[model samples]
Target: MSPLGRPVSLGGGVANRGQVFRLGAAVRRPVTPHSPATHALLRHLSRAGFDGAPRLLSADDRMEMLSWIPGVAARNPLPGWSLSDASLVSVAVLVRRFHDAVRGFDGGPHHWPRPVPPAYSDGLVGHNDLHPGNIVFDGERAVGLIDFDLAGPSGVVWDLATVARCWCPLVADADLPDGFVQGPERRYDRLVMLLDAYGLNRAGRVAVAESLVDNHDWTYRIVTDAASAGHPGFREYWAGVAARTSRARQWAVDHQAELIKAVRR
Candidate 1:
C-alpha cells in the first residue's frame, strides 16, 4: 500500500521511525495510540485558526493520514534562511502558539509511546521533540511542527529547552557536524533572544537553564535506548554520539552562570 503512493522523502530525520508517504492530498504514518491525540490536536489547531500545524484527515489500522503541508523541513544542507535570527524567532513564536493552542485540550486515555518525565507532566502538554527536523519552514519562517509522536504531558520549560538545544543549537563546537554552520560564539545572546522571543519570564528562564542540561542527557538516553531496541535510524545516529552528548552536557554545565545572566536581563 505504501509503495503505491509517492514517497515524500524530504531529506532525512532522526525520528523518521514511520515509513511516511504522500498521497493525493495527505501524508501517512503508522498508527499509534498517540494518533487519536494528534488528530485531536490537529482539530483544535484548525478551530483555533493556527495554520502552523498539519491537519489530521483519516486513519486506519495500519496508517494515519494528515494534510500534506507543503514546505521545507530543516535538513542537513540546512537552508540559509533557516539559520537566521528571524527564523529562530518565528519558530519560537510558533512553539509558543502551539503551547497556547494545546494548553486546555484534554489528552486522557492516550498512551504516549513513552512516559513523560514526572516533573514536566503536571500541567499542559508539550511537543517533546521540538526541533528543526520536526519543523516545516516557509523561506525563513517556521510554518508548522510535524511528527507529534512524542507530544505528551510536559511543561513549557522542558519543551522550550529542547528547542533551545536544537535551535539555538546548544552544542559544543567540537560536536557540531561538518557543513553545519551554527557555532558557539554569542550563544548567551542567542539564548536570551530565544527566551525573549518565547516570552519566558525570569522564573521560566531559570527553569529552562536547568532543563537544558537535563534534557541533553535525557535525549542521549532516549537515543541509546532506541538504538539498543534495534531502531535503525537511532542506531546509526548513536554510533559515535556518546562523546558529543557528554560534551554537550558539559557545555551546559560550564555555561550555567552565563545562561542565568542572559535570562536575568
Candidate 2:
C-alpha cells in the first residue's frame, strides 16, 4: 500500500530540501544517496541499546520510513524554554550518551555521510548535526536526536564542538536568536555548563575550542553546496546569511583562547 503522508515539520536541511511527513506511527522522508548508510547507523544504534534515535522501519527507491519519536523538537526562531540553560545542559547530556552508545561500532562496511577532515575523525560515527531543530525534547529535557542525515566518523571532541556550536551556538552576539540573552559572559558560562555536563576532559575541551572555526567553515561549505544545488529551502535560507556566518566564523577565531581558558577551568 502506498503510504499516506500528513506533512510534518522536522526542521533542518532535509526539511528545507524536501518534504517530511507523519504516516501513522512513522516518519516518511525522501531518500538520498546517504539514506542507506543512515539506515545502517540507526540499526546499529538500536542494537547498541540507544533509544534516543529513531528506528529505521523500511525504505525503497523513493522514501524511507522511521519510527516516530514522540517529543517536541524546536524550529527556527527557537522558543524561550529551548534556549534556557537547563535545555543546554540536557542536550549536552544527551549527546554524551549518544557518543557513548556509538563508541562500540567501528563503521564496518557502510559508506557514511559527511566524513569530517582527518584531523577530526576518530573511527566512531558522530551525529555531526546536533542543531536544536534536530533534537527532540520532552519539555525542557532533551530526550532524543532526530536527524542522522549528517552522521559519519568523527572525533569525540569534534562532535562535541559541533553540538556546542549549535546549542551554545558559539555565534557572534549580533547573530544570537531573538530573546536569547546576549553577552560573552553568558556564552562563557553556558559553554562551561555544557562541557561540564558532557564530562569532557581538559584536553578534549581545548581541542573542541580549537576546532570551532574549522567546524563553522565546514558547516557553511555544506549549506552553500546544497544551496548551489538548488535545494529550495537552502536557497531560501542562504539568502543574505553569508555575512552572519562570516561574523560567526570570526567570533570563533577571536574567542578561541578565552573559550579554552573557560573550558579548562
Candidate 3:
C-alpha cells in the first residue's frame, strides 16, 4: 500500500487547485480569502446530507484539510470520456442534486466568494464553477465536486448557465478540444440534453440562456483581474486563452437566440 501522509500532487488546472496535494485520505491546499466561508458551507453540506462535497477536516492560516473524495478529476486536454453525452448528463444530474441539497443552507454568516448579480442571487449557495476539472467522476457518474473557491449564493439558473457555458460549451470552434468538436445543431442538442437532464422548466431554460452572456463576461473579468494581479497560474493560463475567451464572449452573444430556442424546445 502507498505510504500514508505521502504528498501526491493532483492536477486539474494551472491555478491553486492544480497545486493541491493528497496526503493519505485528506487533501491539503493553500487557504484563500474564501476558505473560511467554504469550510462553513462544507460543514453545512455535510449536515444537509450532501455526500458529493468534501467534508471539512481541519485548518489553520496557511492551509485547510478536506476529506479526499475518491474519483478521478479530468484535467486539461480533457479526456474523450469526460466530454461524452453520458458524462454531460451525469454532471447535470449531480448539479441538480447539489442545488436541492442546499435548500435550507444559511449563507449569511460566511462571506462567500464570487458574488453574482443581485438578480441572480436566488439565495442558493451553488458550485458556480462546474467545469469538468472540478467534478469527480466514477465510471460515467459524477460522484463529487471538489472546488469551492467560487461557490456562492446565486440563482439556480445562473449556476446552470455556467454549466451550459462550459459543457454545452458556448465557445468558438477554434477553442474546442478534439473530443468536443460539434456542429451548431449538435451543440444546441447537447444544451437541450443538459437542461432536460437537469429538469429545468421553460422559465428556467429561458433564464439560463439569458444568463449565458453575463456569465461569460463575469468569468472573463474574474480571470483577467486575477491575471492582472499577477496570479501566476491565471497569468499563464490567461495569456494563452485571452484571445480565445474574447471569441467565446462573442460567440455567446451571437448564439444567444439559438441557445434559448434549443433549451426551450
Q: Which parts of model 1 have CA positions greater than 4 angstroms off?
A: 1-7, 15-18, 76-79, 176-183
TM-score of 2: 0.92
Worst 10 residues of 3 by lDDT: 176-185
lDDT of 1 at 142: 88
- Candidate 2 C-alpha lDDT tens digits along 7-57: 565545543344777777798888878888888889989998998999999
Candidate 3 displacement at residue 112 in angstroms: 1.8
Per-residue CA lDDT of model 1 for 1-265, tens digit only, reads 4544666644455656447767756887777766777777778788988788888887888888788777878864345667688888998999999988887777765666565668767577778888678898888888888888877778899988998887776778775545346466756777888899999989998889878877876767889898999988999888866677788788888988888778788
Q: Give the range of the ten consecutive residues with the poorest summed lDDT in model 2.
A: 9-18
C-alpha TM-scores of all predictions: 0.89, 0.92, 0.94
lDDT of 2 at 251: 89
Question: Of models 1 and 3, which has the larger lDDT?
Answer: 3
lDDT for 3 (candidate 2)? 55
Local distance difference test, each candidate = 0.78, 0.82, 0.84
Would you give me the overall lDDT of model 2? 0.82
Question: Which 10 consecutive positions of candidate 1 have the poorest summed lDDT?
Answer: 175-184
Clashes per model (N, Cα, C within 3 A): 0, 0, 0
Error of 2 at 34 (Å): 2.0
User: For candidate 1, what's the RMSD?
Assistant: 2.6
